[model samples]
Target: MKRILLACSSGMSTSLLVTKMQAYARSIGDEAEIWAVGQDKAKEGLKSADVVLIGPQMSFLKEELQKEAEPLQITVDVIDMMAYGMADGKRAYEQALSLMENK
Candidate 1:
């Protein structure tokens, strides 16, 4: 199973997206451990995550998060703005999978 982490300013904003992503994973019979956390908890969260998807509002943190993830060989990227605004979990989930595949 892949572990996907979503992070934002408060963590709460991305919780709904987590739900949607979970549903999509289930639909495809994909085993994934997906969760969300606030910026303060993100560095710690990265330790267990396979990939980190930052909320659009938290895009500024991507570079820092990427730095943290690089050493661990984990992918860190910003969620697409359009997908995030619409809570398009499939697209977001696909993005995470793509990142891992490319990595």
Candidate 2:
């Protein structure tokens, strides 16, 4: 199973998106572990994450997060603005899978 983590300023903002992603995963019968965390906790989260998606609000932290994730061989990227704004779980899930695939 793949472990995908989403990070934001306080983590709370992404929780809803995580819920949506989880629903999408269940619909497709995917066993991926999807979760969210605050920026301060992202490094720790990266320890077990296969891919990390950053909320648009925290996009500036991507470089630093990537630095931490790179050592762990985890792909880090910012969620698409439109998809994120719309809370498009399917797009988010597909994006996460694509990153894992190309990592």
Candidate 3:
């Protein structure tokens, strides 16, 4: 199973999205273990994740998040705002996989 992490300022909004994404993943038979956390929670649990994805509200932290994730060898990216806003789970999932693979 692939591990995917989603983070946001408060982690509230993204949590809702996580639920939707998980449902979508299940429908497609994608076996991703998804988790959503506040930026602070990410700091505590990042070691377990394969990739870190930031919500648009927390987008500015991308550079910092990347640096922090370096030792863990985890790829991180800011979620596409439009896709996220519309709650497009599959696209976001694809983006995370692509980024991790290229890294």
Q: In lDDT terms, which candidate is top? A: 1
Q: Rank the candidate models, highest lDDT first.
A: 1, 2, 3
- The per-model lDDT (C-alpha) reads 0.93, 0.91, 0.84
TM-score of 3: 0.91
Error of model 3, residue 90, in angstroms:
1.4
**TM-scores for every predicted model:** 0.97, 0.96, 0.91
Off by over 4 Å in 1: none
Which portions of model 2 miss their true places by more than 4 Å? none
The digit string of per-residue lDDT tens for model 2 on 40-88 reads 9988999989999999988888898899888789999999887788888
Worst 10 residues of 2 by lDDT: 80-89
* The best candidate in terms of TM-score: 1
- Order of candidate numbers by TM-score, starting with the best: 1, 2, 3
Q: What digit string (tens of lDDT, one per residue) describes model 1 on residues 1-103?
A: 9999999999998999999999999999999999999989999999999999999888888899899889999999999887788888999999999999999
- Superior candidate under lDDT, 1 versus 3: 1
Model 3 over residues 12-85: C-alpha lDDT tens digits?
87876788778878898989898899888876656889998899988788898888889989888888897689
